[model samples]
Target: MSRTFFTSDHHFGHKNIIDFESRPFSGVEEMNAAMIESWNSVVAKEDKVFHLGDFSFLNRDKTRAIVERLHGYKVLILGNHDRGRSRGWWLDAGFDEVSEHPIVYQGFFFLSHEPMYMNKHMPYVNVHGHIHGQKYEGKSYFNVSVEHWEYKPVPFEQIRDSVAADEEQ
Candidate 1:
């Protein structure tokens, strides 16, 4: 059966991101290859992946090539950096869908590239990316930045369980 996954802030082909995020890879090439392998390790071709944003900093051709190689029906929610390109540009780059704004998913989850405002009193949980290694406090927010997930996509069930556990507390 196909599964759903979430991830963001890949910054692929952005050499400076290695130092900025304190990523372990020696270079952009290594980081890109390792992330590709890690993504494919858990995501099958039939799976669906929601990429929160900042997918890449490479040129169109390079970015498209990387996106084409990943395993999933890809969806991209525009991030701060991603605004440099148009939605149609992202579509041509291989994403199956593109959203310029945060979207409500599964009724209660708010999906966005940047974390949305949330509180315990609120019914919706924010699932987002963009801060990289940093995270907001509270169970109402879930950060799926690649740095937080060991450079791989996280299954939606994992996010669901985390929220459920937090709600119990």
Candidate 2:
């Protein structure tokens, strides 16, 4: 069996993620390296990772190079920033799928980004990125940005109860 992990919004080559967040990272290269390190630290050969969205910046080759270094089978849930050739490049990088709707794995919903409003009709609690908790308050969501400029995977057990409850509705 494979252990599944969820995370989003790495923005690997985006220098602004550090400046806007007031992170200690000095440059985009450092930030990207940190993300790769953080990911590889937790990821193992038998693990599966779901990257919700905004995996990289404007450069497809940069994104592909980073994705190639990370461990696990990556599944790309395409985000707003992921467009055009970037999508295809991501597939080539070894992502299992790229889509708009939620990708259910182990009975939980895996979505690239979150919605502005709540979805009462849906049965599953959305696991997303897009809006970090620092920007949006009281959403009961998790952020993947760890240690200023890192990407960490969050397990389903950490937030499964709430998600499962929502799915039952």
Candidate 3:
């Protein structure tokens, strides 16, 4: 069956991100290749991937090329770094949809490009990206950034199960 996945901050072709994020790769090309490999390994061609943003840093055509090589039917939750492009540009680049705000999924989780606050009254977990390697623990929030998820798209089922477990604890 086709599955759903979540990830963010690929930052494709951004040479400086390696140093800024302390990514272990020796260079941007290697980092980009590894990330693509990791993503394709777990994501089937028909899977739905919610990319929580900062998806790429390359020029328009180059970014589109990278997107074309990626697996899955992708949706983008626009991040701070996702500027300088029209919505049509993102669609043309291969995203099925793009949103500037958070979306609540399956009635139990809030999906967004940036972390959001959830209180006991909200009755939903906040699943987000943007903090990269850091995460807020012992709370109803989860980070799905590439830096924290081994540079691969994490299945939504896994995240849901994790949230369930957290709720129980």
lDDT of each: 0.94, 0.66, 0.87
The candidate 1 region of ten consecutive residues with least summed lDDT is 114-123
lDDT of 2 by residue, 1-169 (tens): 6777878877777888787766668898887787788788888977988877777774656666777788998887777777544556778765766765556555635354654344545444456777643433333344443432245787656557544553466
TM-scores for every candidate against the unseen true structure: 0.98, 0.78, 0.95
Task: Report clashes for each candidate as comma-separated counts.
Answer: 0, 2, 0
Can you write out model 1's per-residue Cα lDDT over 44-65, one digit (the tens) per residue?
A: 9999999999998988889899
Using lDDT as the measure, the top candidate is 1
Clashing pairs in 1: none
Better of 1 and 3 by TM-score: 1
| Model 3 TM-score relative to the real fold | 0.95
**Tens digits of per-residue lDDT for model 3, 74-159:** 99988889856777778888788988788889887889888887766777788888899888875588899899888999998899
C-alpha root-mean-square deviation, each candidate: 0.7, 3.7, 1.1
RMSD in angstroms, candidate 3?
1.1
lDDT of 3: 0.87
